[model samples]
Target chain A: MFPALLHDALTVGAVLFVLGLVGILTRRNLIVMFLSAELMLQGISVSLVAWSRYHGDFGGQALVVFVLTVAACEAAVALVFVLQAFSRTGRLDAAAWQSLRDAEVPRRIDRELPATDAAPPVWPQLTPAGVRPRRDETAEPEREHV
Target chain B: MIAALLPTGTTPLLAAAVASGTVSLWLLLPQAPGSDWLGHRRGALGLVLGVAALAALAWAGRRLGGLGDEAVFQIVSLVAIVGGAATVVTRSPVYSAIWFALALAGVAGVLLVLGAQFLGVATIVVYAGAILVMFLFVLMLAQPSGLAPYDRVSNEPLLAAIAGGVLLALLTTSIGRLSADPPACCTIPSRADAVATAPVGPAAADALAADPLARLGRELFGRHLLAVEAAGLLLLVALVGAIAVVSRGEVAEATRKGAS
Candidate 1:
């Protein structure tokens, strides 16, 4: 006999959705933006479940399963893109990526933006193929700093 | 005249309440550079105002039916809001991810309270367990140092908050009408009533409809078969694409490094 439990649930869902939207609109970190998108998905799922329960129907639950499926796929694709973006630019900042825009449009230049502190990402160098293992006995142990 | 102006229903009250909450939440949201506006004190004020708005609206709704239900709803709702706010406001990407997980957990709790046990458990397993872990892994891979410039500052905080607040206000006003009465189209008969009243049909159909889980399975496969298949196909394509993209990136980087 819970009065307005459904309403409360809906309100909570809406709040969560808006928060996620704010996170997406504000946060520049590519990964955090993705996480915020996931948050928005969670919000929608909550509302769907609430409505499903209110009506005592299973359709909503079934739909949630499909939503989960789509989310999993999206996460996989998004992570790959994030890694690619990170590889191209050492910084995870979304602002660093502007080359994708149309050629007709001039690139945005923020004069006040702070200079990037990190060096260009260095890919691990692989030894020449079929080369014999040569231990550098004279070489000092690399300093281990994490 | 006052009553007419006030619009005597939960809709207006809920709209006002949610508007207050959203504004308070916007105020509480941490800004970059730590100085320009809306300091920590404002956040505290926002918290108080948001809670008060919800309290006042709850009073007007007159739907606080039972103690147990009310208590559970309040706890879960609070968790959801706090976790969501934390997710958005935290400076660190890792912490944001963790908070997002917490918020999703709170959502799952709400789902469970609403009797969508299956969806709740599925959400925990899929979102909390699998997706969150993957996000954490990617986050670590991308920024092993645990600090990044992008993570520190947000873009267009004021503008985004205004847009979010406006959207929340609109949604609250519309969705609040549901409290007046459940949507007539969504009304569903109880399983017992349905089974007893249904004319003798296929025994299998009747049995499937009797069990909620079975009904869900049948509905998914029976009516939404193509959608389910499409979902599975989408997953396969995504998996292959992710693997292909990662491998190609690695190879391209290796060759570039070798040439350099």
Candidate 2:
């Protein structure tokens, strides 16, 4: 027989689902948004399992297997999309993709996006270790800037 | 509406507790002003208020029905709720991802408590093991440069919290209503009817009531055979799609050189 915790289980699942919803709504980072979507999936899985136990049926458990499959595919496709977007934009912010919208829609802001706080990629500087490099005065005074 | 949902005796106290708690959470979560999380006065007050709401909800639940799987439910649900909220509120994406795994572990605990042995274990294996790993992998590659600008600020915390609170209240209240007045859909069979309708053959009933995991396998493979095959096809397609997507960058580069 199903125990009396049925409502409690549902409530907990709902709570988690709502919190995940808030995460998705409030966060702008694409990866975090995807994680929040996964959170929502977890919430639904919890509810399905609870209902399965209540009915003394294994159908819900079987269904969750499908859910897992879908979630996996979703993650794969979504990550690929993020990678592609990052290659073009060089950042993970969702706002960067506003260009994808229809031309009729007004832009939110005309100004350039604020410079990201993330430090630019650092490359190792190869300096001559043994001796001072001789500058060729004849080579147009070797410009100071690259 | 709150009064209509809960019993008359606990209604006022419950409403006050829930209201104050929502307010506290609203203030506690990082707002536009961005108060210091560790030492802020409102943050501490929000924590207390949130705990008070949890206590009130538990009390109401206990009063309505005897705690089923009492200890396990209490501990796991508490942990799940706390971990979930933390996942939502944490500023750092990696920390949020880690907290999400913790929340997922807690949800898996709930699934176990509900007698879903396979579902619980699978959730852990699939989510914590595979999905979280993929998330972390993408997160790392995407953010090779530390925290991004978007991670530092939330889009709309207050509005999201209000929406979340409203949805939570609606869901919990519906749960309470359903508990007090169960819908006609789920009618449990009486012992006499169960025995009378039971399979006459000993093996039949035994097989039906065999180990849950074994029964789950039978149900999946036997009843849902087509769905299972379809799922397999879907997985294969996804694998191919992922491979194609990842390789497109190189293919495009090669094509560009040929054209030039």
Candidate 3:
């Protein structure tokens, strides 16, 4: 019975850890990543508590108190960052900021370059008389300067 | 005191039976929709099941001559695992947090059973009251979308299989090793009799009678003072860090507006 209980705890902990890992790996959204990290933290806390019980020591349980505190602190910081990012760009899609990978550049070169060229790209010229330029078309000139 | 408590054998058996019955009931209850409020039928059913499970486990422990430290540990671990899994699998974040709190409470119960009264109480105070409430707060404020059934179906099975396989391997190996050379006798003490002997009026007094708080205080203040202090400082740092993080978004937005 003892073994069975221990096995269950370990299984749950392992699942949480794995879920967190997958979330971190596959999830592009920053908020989801933060949540996944919380999952991993939870996994470790449960494991620690289990070990403490198995050994008849309070240390493991005590450590969990600190871990919870840390998790709370982490969530606060991460969410703030997420909110800030969201405000800057209306969308939360992670891929939207692919251009931010470069430290010096504020805009994506691939997106902004064609219009700022000595001549606008042929694609725009090919548009029918009534067609309007896309939203990204306006930023092309600034992109080429960088 | 130990001698006075040791004579009663049936009490432990009764406790064990009750605890086991409660656990079984919890497992057997029909899955409730996660959106139901605590007052709803499903919520009531879950609560009833939880209580039954806890009662059964507690009774089982008492009946078994009070669960040994290791047994208590395992029981708590099982509770936590079940509760945690429920939290993750549930469709509603609110329900998930509730289950998470249950798991935390179960961990505290284990600590108490193991004679780590201070740790157990602290676990409940910090985890159930502070940590889980914070999770609930975030869930409310953020309002992340409810977990879609397809999402759960797609991910849970694979995760469950991997976790189960690993756990099975570990448990099988450990059991094999232990069986090769079983221990002679129980090393852990049973507290059921002591607990049962206490007067039923005040819970705190009853707890103190079993294990005085002074001993724990001495241990904390004497040898573990440094560690305790460190933990305290860590908590302070975390609190400050959380505040900073949560407010940073607003700060950044302000700065951006000012710049513009």
Question: Largest lDDT belongs to which candidate?
Answer: 2
Question: How many residue pairs clash per model?
Answer: 0, 0, 21
Question: What tens digits encode model 1's per-residue C-alpha lDDT throughout A112-142?
Answer: 4233324667999987889686666557467
State how far residue B101 of model 2 sits from its true place (Å).
1.2
TM-score of chain B of each: 0.77, 0.80, 0.55
lDDT of 2 by residue, A16-72 (tens): 788789888877788888888888888888888777766666787898899999999
Clashing residue pairs in candidate 2 (N, C-alpha, C atoms within 3 angstroms): none
lDDT of 1 by residue, B90-135 (tens): 8678898888888877888887787766677888899889999999
Q: Mind giving the per-residue lDDT tens digits that candidate 2 earns over B112-215?
A: 88877888898889989998999899888878555555675676567877887788777766766666655677555433345448866664444226488888
Query: Candidate 3 regions off by >4 Å?
Result: A1-65, A68-146, B1-79, B144-160, B175-212, B258-260
Candidate 1 has a DockQ of 0.35
Error of 1 at B205 (Å): 12
Query: Which has the higher lDDT value, candidate number 2 or candidate number 3?
Result: 2
Q: Which candidate ranks first by TM-score, i.e. highest?
A: 2
Q: Residue B202's C-alpha lDDT in candidate 1?
A: 78
